[model samples]
Target chain A: MQLDVVVGFFLLGMVAQLLKAPIKMPKGLYESLTLFLLIAIGLKGGVALNSHASGDLLIQAAAIIGFGLVLPLIAFPILYKMGGLSRIDSASVAAHYGSVSVATFAVAMTVVEANGIEYEPYFPLFVALLEVPAIAVGLWLARDRNQELDLKKAAHEIFLNQGVLLLVGGLLIGWWAGARTDSLMPFFSSLFHGVLALFLLEMGRIASSQLGVLRNFGSFIASFGVLMPLVGAGLGALLAHALELSTGGVILLATLGSSASYIAVPAAMVVALPKANQSLSITASLAITFPFNVLVGIPLYSVLVGHWS
Target chain B: MKKRAFAFEMAVSFVLMALGLVLVQLGLPGYGLVVVAAILMGLSFVTRKWVAQTANVKVAAPKRGNH
Candidate 1:
């Protein structure tokens, strides 16, 4: 039942794109859907934040941030030396993998909820936190003293990014309002799956549009996109185990770790690493990593979490 | 000009936050709605910056010809 609803919409998206169907989500509607999902996730997290021990939350947060920072560092060397990508391209791609994708996260949430699995609510906070550091790491990896870095612009782009602001702001509002805001449960919670289905349908369309570019990127990059998520999930599983997170929390973290950012990081990279190959990084994230996570990584991670726990 | 844009964005964000609060009070599913408000506010700021940047590019293009 869980698989059919989530994956069915995604497959429908791909089929629509494949058939050259004229169906399209309105220009800003997709963004609106994204904003709604993020906030919904954040508010839920805020409500649950008080129940968890502050120390455990802090440790989990720190570990997730560390995961974000480390993923790029691991990716850069592989891209630069093994994949034969230039420093800029490597950093750009690495930054993308390091950052979390909200769409992918949303899909994972849907799967978990459909399956009646409980997860950590503050995962949205991790989403917000994970967005920034990888970007910094990416820019640093590509840094050259000869090139003038626009520190001010980069900071503004990262901190004030729409994704980060929405998630963080929602978290604060949800936390502050708590059960007082329970009235919103009907909209935020009940309608979540429907909104998610709509969003995934669009995601399928977008991901399918990139199908033609896969061959051009070569077998190596394509393989890396699929394999890296598994590696990241493995790391997430280990972290989740260490933190003693519940099975649901473990899967969520694994999903977070496995997913790649197509939105926030790309926007920042446009400003910070202007010379980076935009197509390569975008394709890697949106075309390859995004689909893989939604289709395979989420379920795989859930199984792994079950085994681990 | 930038300051004005920033202030405008802040105003919009505040309004959205208020609307979200009202929704919550009304026992509606408003948490996600509030975040949407925040996102829209941020988009306003981003669009303003984009427009300003485009203008800068246009202005700077002719100047670069002199070099």
Candidate 2:
């Protein structure tokens, strides 16, 4: 799996920062790109599901949800005990890991398309399904059972968060509109990669910014950042194989497993786990895990597909 | 210098690499990675001796001059 050329933009952004070159991705443009990618991915999945929806999908959906739930469970112990993070911080980091990164997924999708590897089109549906479970699980782990969780607020964060709302909303619109949504292909699907490159450029700048702050838990957290994703991808490959997904499906699943959230989880955790040190998890997810997954884990997971089968 | 502490960290990382291979054989690649992580935690514990040693090392105080 050759590295995608779009990743070059990310390296460019990081290099520019290192050189102290004047460059800025406007706040508005960054937000718009994020929204564009989210809606595009969701719409594509919804369109695909219009034809392919079936009983087996229900099983796969349950399994995907289970996958989301399990990732954070596995990560919390390593973080709290091994990484020596506080309970709140550990739960926060675990939640971020367990959730998926849209940008990484977009990059993997680009590579898959460039290679002409056929994958299940309804994959975006699985993406929507995956966004929530880890967050709920993480919150459960962090909060005391005796203390009442504000159900309304939690529901809003999990279901109505920007990532979920756009993905699921786009999915439903595509599913309902079906053939009518074809007109949308020009904007949502065609311009997808271009927007993603811009998004990643901004991500590179942000990830580079996280570098100076990493000294606090640099080694242990960094180690976990790289290692845990591999673990997630390894497990995801096994699950995908058991479900008998295609080679492309397997790769996507593995990529999904390895990618961690910098967007949805942080937005939700800020409201949910206010006392938790958000920077620790954000630095680990964005600065460490996100870059590693985009650069290395995606390709490595692709290679492991042959062995795991 | 407690070379033992540094050696232990190095040894743990190498053992994890080998352990990951073994677990892959068992088709538990994910669990293998997790197990490696759990054990990797131990390296942090063993390195505390080195941390203590470094903390105790006396640093020469800077000579005060014109501000």
Candidate 3:
């Protein structure tokens, strides 16, 4: 059932790309779609909790943050060396491994929730938080203060990017609104699932388009894109075992562990390290890793999570 | 001009965030904000080309007169 959903999205995205219809959705529309999905999930989660606080929630949130920080630290070195990329390219790619894709993570949260699995409502904030640090690390790796303009630009890119600000802002708003159940739930609650499916469809469109770029990537980069996620998942499971997280939380950690930053890191790299090979990083993230995670990584991590639980 | 460039980027980001909020508030379906971001980003790249062209023009005009 899970495999079918994953493959179904992939095929839809693939078909959309092949049609090559010039129906370029506007940037605002795409972002709003994603934001709506996230807030809806958040609100629904909030409504589910219904103001009940749990000791386990904080632990799960912490695990998300912990895995968010540590997985990239471990994953970057392997991807860098294995891909045989330069310091800048390697670092750019590595930073992506660290940051979480809120969209992808949101999708996973939806999957878990639909399965009647309990998860942390605060997990979305963790997703927002995880995006910037690896960017800082990536920038630090390519740091050359000699270029004042570039440094300034990188700072702006990190804090002020539309996606960053909105995701972070929306998460905060969702929390605030989620708390005010009487007024907010009407707008944010009912729309969660439909928005998520729509966003996933758009992602399908993107992954399909990038499929052509997979072979263009060298063996090392392509293989590393697939392999690093599994390695990261294993590390996450180990951490989950040590932390003694719940089965659901363990799966969340492993999913968080294995996912890469296609959105945030690439935007940061474009600003901070413009000379680095955009094609390599973007292609790896889009063509190889994104599909790999949605297809293979989710199930693999779920199994690990189940074992740990 | 550098400050202006910074302002430009900031303004663009603000517009995007605002647009995203409005669309969701209005009940539009599809992830519009991310797509809007990607479009504005692509548009910004085109604008950078314009800036580069203008810069080249400035450099060339002065050089031709000096020569």
Q: Best DockQ goes to which candidate?
A: 2
lDDT for A292 in candidate 2 is 76
| Candidate 1 residue-wise lDDT, A69-145, digit = tens | 99999888877776678889999999999999988888887788778888776777888888889999999999997
Query: TM-score rank, highest first?
Result: 2, 1, 3
Point out the higher-scoring one by lDDT: 2 or 3: 2
Q: Which ten residues in a row have the lowest lDDT in candidate 3 chain A?
A: A214-223
Off by over 4 Å in 1: A1-4, B1-67
Candidate 2 lDDT, A14-125, residue by residue in tens: 7787777867766599899999999999999888999999999999999999999999999999788765678889999999999999888888888878878788999999
Give per-residue lDDT, candidate 1, residue B25: 82
* Model 1, global lDDT: 0.79
- Candidate no. 1 TM-score: 0.79
- Fnat per candidate, as a fraction, reads 0.00, 0.03, 0.00
- Cα DockQ of the candidate 1 complex: 0.01
What would the TM-score be for candidate 3 when compared with the true structure? Answer: 0.70
lDDT of each: 0.79, 0.81, 0.63
- Work out how many backbone clashes candidate 3 has: 26
